[model samples]
Target chain A: MTITLNNRIETFSPQEMSITQIMDEKSFHFKMLIVKLNGTLIPRESWPLTVVRDGDRLDIIHLVSGG
Target chain B: MTIIQNITSHLSVKKAGIAGAGGLGSNVAAALVRSGVGHLVIADYDIVTKPNLNRQFFFADQEGQSKVDALRENLLHINPKADVEAHFCKITALNAGSLFGSCDVVIEAFDCADEKKWFAEWMIAHYPAKPLIMGSGIAGYGSPETLRVQRSGNLYICGDQRETNEKLVPLLAPRVIMVAMMQADLALELLLQEKPL
Candidate 1:
């Protein structure tokens, strides 16, 4: 399955995965993250339960410090 | 037509809420006030110190003063008629909405990744209709050309997008204020675009 992650399309073998699994697989280990799946925000508490299907568009933003 | 008259006529009735009164917050608040934003709600629990003088808006004389108080004083000095509300407390998911609910736009000027994430998420979740201006990665001696503004829905993020480790590079005034001014300009632009209810 192919999906756009941060505007870059990538293929995944599993075809489906939880948001948490996707983050872990992609090494998005940053403590500060804003995850949006197809324009809907996935709360931190819901990452594990939320599943990302094929063709989904994910926007993963990292906000850092210094002002 | 005088600049002050034009600014007052355009912005005398708008209100802005700044989440942190540090380098970005103080400078953003000052620019908004000078532009004649009618009211401001500024929050911060930290105190000014000698090191803050390098980039923050507080003067050396303001050392040891609470950031919210010092920032309010400085803003008032700029526009005495400006209604400045200072809150000396840490903003969390619970109180962020209530504290800034009445504001037309919210500015995120936090000093930590966790705080920025929390505030952005909370605002996006609870206040979906409001505009949120945030900053990230304004540290060291980065070139001005690297800075850029990106927007997604109601969220506008302005910064170099390069994470500068504070330990490795000190936060300087030029980059910090440049991003702050970007946030301020975006806030004003959003405010101007809104049609009165």
Candidate 2:
């Protein structure tokens, strides 16, 4: 499945992806983050339960730390 | 010519939180207060020491005074209308949520090299909806042009995002305050966007 991630095209194997799985796959490990799915804010607790499908929009805004 | 527009949202920022009351924290508090954030909650365990005068917002007379207290006084001096809360203890991952839970936005202003990421993690994990603005590379004072703010979702990072911490190169006032001001500016933007007037 291909979806929009950070304004870019991304493809996952199962045609669907959980927020946590995508974060792991993309190595978005910055501790400070803001995750949104299809324009709705996704609480941290919902990352695991929130799944994305084909063509869905997911934005993972995280503070890139060089500390 | 129009110098600016719609900047009247200062009061709309409502409450902001600063986790550390040092250079970045204190200056951020000052900027937010002057800019009109309704309430500010600041936390820090350290006191105003001589070396801190190089960049922090404390005074010589404030030496031996706790940073949280001194900063509160200084902010109030700038804007008597400023609503400030001072915490006289260290902010750890454990107490971060309670200290800043009511804040509309949280500024990660710790001066330590090691605690930045951990504290950011704790705040975001506990309050996912609250915007967290962090200062990453604010140490030293030469590259002024490198300072910038990057935003994603509810997280904003301001600074060169490359320089080492204070231990390696002293925290000069100019660069630190510049980054602190940038963080405060971004906070204003986030708050306005959060509670559109």
Chain A vs native chain A, TM-score per candidate: 0.94, 0.89
Clashes by residue pair, model 2: none
lDDT per residue for candidate 1 within B73-153, as digits (tens), equals 998899889999999999987788788999999999999888898888888889888899999879987579988786767
Cα lDDT tens digits for candidate 2, A1-67: 8998876888889878789999999987765565768757677889999989999988765443332
Alpha-carbon runs more than 4 Å astray in model 1: A1-29, A44-57, B1-7, B195-197
Q: Output DockQ, candidate 1.
A: 0.55
lDDT of 1 at B72: 91
Worst 10 residues of 2 chain A by lDDT: A58-67
Every model's DockQ, to 2 decimals? 0.55, 0.15
Worst 10 residues of 1 chain B by lDDT: B1-10
| Per-residue C-alpha lDDT of model 2 across residues B1-197, encoded as one tens digit per residue | 22222454445348998988888899889888877787999988888999889889989999999999999999889888777989998887677768888888899888654577567556656777788898877767686998877565566778865634345676688988998899988887777763434
Instruction: For each candidate, give the TM-score of chain B.
Output: 0.95, 0.89
Can you give the lDDT of residue A42 in candidate 2? 78
